[model samples]
Target: MTCSPDDFRAAMRRFPSGVAIVAAGSAPHRAGMTATAICSLSADPPQVLACLNRLSSTCRAVEDARFFSINLLATSQLALARIFAGLEGGVSADQKFTAGVWRLGVTGAPILEDAVLTFECALVTAHPASTHNIVIGEVRHITGEVAEDALIYRSGVFGRWTGLAVTQPHLS
Candidate 1:
């Protein structure tokens, strides 16, 4: 028998993940969503992947624009993340963007100016998965350097990374 949605969600909640905002489009058509399903896919050509729900407006915008941005959030930006995630006091989609300073990237997608790391990417391909689509983008441009601390989500709670207590002994 297949696992129920509640079972799957509870299991997934045990995994810690970084928070990000996936943005696409411009002006009146822009769309974004808070996501924790983003990850690096390759380093050779610089690629990244962001998984989005198939029925989300953000997903539709990304598919239509053929471009999108993955803006990694800083620990201080939890409120902004909540806005984008549609959880901040019921703010509407169009108004959610007002919470942050946004700038157009090379791909014409909105990039959060204060993001710890931002990747401007061109759509590569998308693979359908159950209730979501794995959207792959080739990193065409990037903004900001990695930050010391990042916003993390786990077990329905958000936290900040304070760096590792023990440093790595070796370097690549």
Candidate 2:
């Protein structure tokens, strides 16, 4: 039995994930894309993994620059996420940076100043996997404070994650 692409996507959408913008390159030659397929790969060496579409300009930029920044979004950054995702009308690739306050990281990758968290990384490796590349990086710098609310995506909708209260169960 084989699962269809649409079915696989639908199934995956059931799992909510944090939103992020993976950006590379410098101004006037930069590229970025909204992504949810980023996660911590290791802690001891401080590494992260981000999946980029093989055909995306961002992926090519990462390949050429050998550096990238993962800007984890806060709830207030929904507009920025939409812009990077190409969901905002009249905003072209060259104009995306205008929507957010950005700065150059140590690696020269563009970082969102107001992101919930920003990880500037040096590209370690990128492995081709089907339609995407599994890009790994060693974190070189980090910034931003812990936000009270974070942007999340689920079922094709953008949302926020607030602190959830957990109650301890009573035991005899």
Candidate 3:
């Protein structure tokens, strides 16, 4: 049960996760970040949870905005994800938004129009998790593109989901 950080990374590499960008636009300091630490938190009211680093520029955007949107990237969107994730400081946050195409979600967060699936939500709750904040959001609107394959993250790199049948029968 007790694993070092290296062990934690190794364990996580086994569970491939869908790649997404969480974005908000309450200020000129719009927030967007590549994320794989996303999960469903509720069903009845439709909620989602995303874990965020406290010092990330994306965190500041969420802290100031009432709502945010999740952009599920397709394989082609990998470049976009990297751009947002690569921005290293406060001065570059706004410029990152300019690199992608977006539309205002119900709460004004920018939803990447080319995303395979998108979610807009109202902030509902947050809890501290050691070094990251687990923020929950109540879903307000969602859109999807069934034909596009999803992007995935595993083994410290980005890849696209093939959507092939699981003939291997392995849990992962």
Could you say which candidate leads in lDDT? 2
For model 1, how does the per-residue alpha-carbon lDDT over 1-172 read when each residue is reduced to its tens digit?
A: 9999999999999899999999998888888999999999999999999999999989988999999999999989999888998887867655678888998987788899889999999999989999899999999998887565789999999998666788788878
**Please, what is the TM-score per model?**
0.92, 0.93, 0.88
Predictions: Cα RMSD each? 1.7, 2.7, 3.2
Q: What is the Cα-based lDDT of residue 163 in candidate 2?
A: 55
Candidate 2 lDDT, 34-84, residue by residue in tens: 999999999989999999999999999999999999999998889899999
Full candidate order by TM-score, most accurate first: 2, 1, 3
Tens digit of lDDT per residue, candidate 3, span 1-172? 6779988879989799999999987546687888999999889999999998978777767767878998889887777878877744543676777766887877788888888999898888768888888889999999886567788988878887665675766676
User: What is the lDDT of every predicted structure here?
Assistant: 0.90, 0.92, 0.83
Query: Which regions of candidate 2 deviate over 4 angstroms?
Result: 169-172
TM-score: the better of candidates 1 and 3: 1
How far residue 29's Cα lies from its native spot in candidate 2, in Å, is 0.1
Query: Worst lDDT window (10 residues) for model 1?
Result: 88-97
In model 1, the runs with Cα more than 4 Å from the true position are 146-148
